[model samples]
Target: MNTSASDPVTDAPTKAAPIIEAQGIDKLYESFQALYDIDLQVMDGEFVALVGPSGCGKTSLLKILAGFEQPSRGSLEIQGKSVVGLPPSQRPTRMVFQKLALFPHKTVRDNIAFPLKLAQVSRAEQDARVAEMMDLMHLPSAYATRYPAQLSGGEQQRVALARSMVSRPSVLLLDEPLSALDVKLKKVLQTEIKHLHRTIGTSFVHVTHDLEEAMMLADRICVMRHGRILQNGSPTDIYYRPADAFIAGFIGETNLIPVQMDGAAFDNPALRCADPTLDEAQFSPGHAGTSGLLMIRPELIVMRTEAPDAAEVDCVMEGSVEEFFIKGSSIQYRIAVEGLREPMIVDVQGTATPPATVAQKVWLSFQRRDLYLLGEG
Candidate 1:
């Protein structure tokens, strides 16, 4: 719950020791390259998430860091020590895979105690640690005797987390750990994972395709694409100021309109704004004829009836409501503007009052600052 905006570890002048570091990491599978010079760093006790599509090499990079596979080029260091040749067990890292990997016959207590037994901890010590881990994971003491088959999917995941943490490794790598659980169970486990990180104070490198999960739990998110890091920042940063079109569209719902920057305004007679100087930052002096993308979030745009006689600062665009969908807490509208090729999506909270029907004439408007500029298609 230490939610200060400024970083607490590094006082000022000096940089803090990174819990995990990977530089110029490369992985190749004969002809195709799975990873290419991927560089990343995780601070002590930070929860960092790696997110991307299926073939984005997220798993390969994580495996490389875990010592499951050595990188073809580059280096990896954990807790300031080079672990290139070290075995997974020797490195101060524990990985919890998608499959909880719990032994079906073993009881919860026995499962959590497995790591301790492998390390040759005394019987009494192992029992004590197992009890502590179960308590930390909020599992009932009576459930310790029950087998994995008797536990729910979430319970199994908790057991996996407990097992991984039993050794008190400096870093924990979670690879899509909640993908198998149902929606409700996934949401619950997400919170549990966040809480677990707070209590344990271990650096967590979580890999997932779920953007919302990454946004909610991660202190920083590293967005990957085609085996490379595209953008790395906090959730707010990624959502508000996406570094590229790929990230802007991937992290959340966005309408990337193809437009040209003419002077300070986005040109398209149909989508012209009140203030022509609105999107001036999108264009450079020498880049006049270049095409650019206007990144607009659905939530930032509002639907208004009749023209307002207010200041000449607001940007307005005319579009006809093509269709609408009722989400739990909001309504989504798909509107087709006059000149735009694709329909613009607008999201409004609490079921847009007197919602528009199909082919209804409507005006979509948004502020200047809300628009983000990105490279053209």
Candidate 2:
């Protein structure tokens, strides 16, 4: 478990001092509880995305981190200093909101300089810092005189980010800053934000409901539910080894077929789980009868007109292509395999030749090693 920047893979935490730490954090609004006992640690220069359904406490946590709202209980620290009672202005953090919140009347330079001014930095220093931040955002120097109303959405977004970065805060908090943009623009900024994070190397705690956005930007992901932290780990861990069926369904597209113990091995009537990778070690007594899901990613299944020998493939099932739609570079298939109530999705490259058409028989073969057994669906 490497916890330092020198490690090639940071699937585990880094050894650096946490840039932000929360212990036993809770939030309550009179009789209503907005957060449960939450403990989190964000390492210096790491990008952590807080994601969940609406009203799931992601935003509440971010607000607490920025000092806009105090936690109902527990302690928080930034740079190892307790900030339980600190005001937003006094904290070593900055928040960029979905609305961008650039001053309508202020020019780009002034908007970016406002935070430095509040800190009472010298005018010369403020100008130098703003110029440096603008360069980091790749905003042209010529745009300094333009107001928010004159710049495009991407430009305004960069300006808002510039303002946040100019302060050189220990951590940056984002509240769905790109949620309002069109899909194309949102994707473009997602890449830019991730790139900027690497260039600036600041701890970013982004709050969003968009799973793709979280996957695109974060070094680590914290999944929340009902005001509680449900899971936290690397993207691969979260996707390939989800803690539960709900997490699997929410994180990406997949076919979660019900499975049960058929004698010593797990079995799904609709699909087969005969891969050698699975055995007694993978099952528990409680899951003997029927309480698991055979998680198969669409991309993991190979579509074939002729079935492979059972001994050669992990799991094999016959199905007919009931429907399909072009999805960018891949074709998404809705296959009605034997015994499954709902159709399963099989994703294949768009260039697949002699493609399977509606009502066409096809074989869905997936490696047993690729099958993930999820507990009690």
Candidate 3:
């Protein structure tokens, strides 16, 4: 893998100082190890999301980096200065909690102006800045006087966002900022947030368990599990080239097929595909007794009622359709292949494509290059 400077998508082009860096971060609660040697860096003006299931330590790591929680071990630096002893309020980073944490007593303008007030900006300057922030967030100036309880959920979200951005913090930590909104509102907010980030260019470290949201918003994603980062990369890299079975399964829908390698070709009882593109003689002699899994995405599998006209690999699999799900953009077919414990999933696009109903026999095939090889669990 050419993971060098030439690969600008994954590799850093220059040694610019990371806006925030956490190294060897270890946190423990009595006997329970919360975080283990966690290492992460956020480039200046980058939008990064920490994503995982519940209790993945994403929130804990964010707190530690924001100076809200002290680490048991390791160091955190901002612009090359160690900030171990700094208090959360003193840190250049600010956090927007899931609750929005707005003061119900204060009006939208007052809430946004609170940060400027603490910073001791002049009264005239504070008013001017508040107006500018409200405009930037697309919040109406008339809504400034309304309290949190008076505004709609979406409006209140804008208020909270305006408050956070008003300070112009070097870094912003968002903890599931859009989780409270309805699906439609969440989507609108997602686009708004993306546009806001582009305009501000401030470093954003967003934490969420929503995979699609993370994929859409993050310049890079940090996938965490059991308090450790399992993988970190752009959405395409993480989705198409998952490092292990856990990552492969977590990122998206996949069909994990057990396989054994004979020379350079993958041999499987279920997979009858042939690849003329790969050199069969150059296969690596994998570790003995170590099983392998072939990861194939649902979309990569082609379903045909009959035979294909193209001279493709005849890796045909005959299975009875167990279920068919009508996803808005695509249809998902679950096939119960004989001798397999799990049903094979295949995604077909377009409404014009013939639907494969339950109990119908179908053939599936795909190219070898599209199949990812990984160590079996």
Q: Cα lDDT of all candidates, in order?
A: 0.86, 0.86, 0.84
- How many collisions between residues are there in candidate 3? 0
192-292: candidate 2 lDDT, tens digit per residue: 89988998899999998899888889999999999999899998777777777778888989888777755545666667646534655344232435457
TM-score versus the correct structure, for each prediction: 0.92, 0.91, 0.91
Query: Which of candidates 2 and 3 is the stronger one according to TM-score?
Result: 2
Candidate 2 stretches with Cα past 4 Å from truth are 1-14, 262-264, 273-290, 352-354
lDDT by residue (tens digit), candidate 1, 125-235: 998899999999889999999999999888889999999999899999999999988999999889989999999899999999899999999999999999999888999
Tens-digit lDDT track for model 3 on 1-377? 65434435765565668999999999998898889999999999999999888998999999998888899999999777899879977888888899988998998989999989989999899889899989988888999899999988998988888888888899989999999789999999999999989999999999997889999999999999999998889998788778777888888788987767654556666656645223432222232333567777899989977766547654666788999888878999999988678899999995865577889988888877676666665
lDDT of 1: 0.86
CA lDDT, candidate 2, residue 258: 74
Report lDDT (Cα) of residue 219, candidate 1: 97
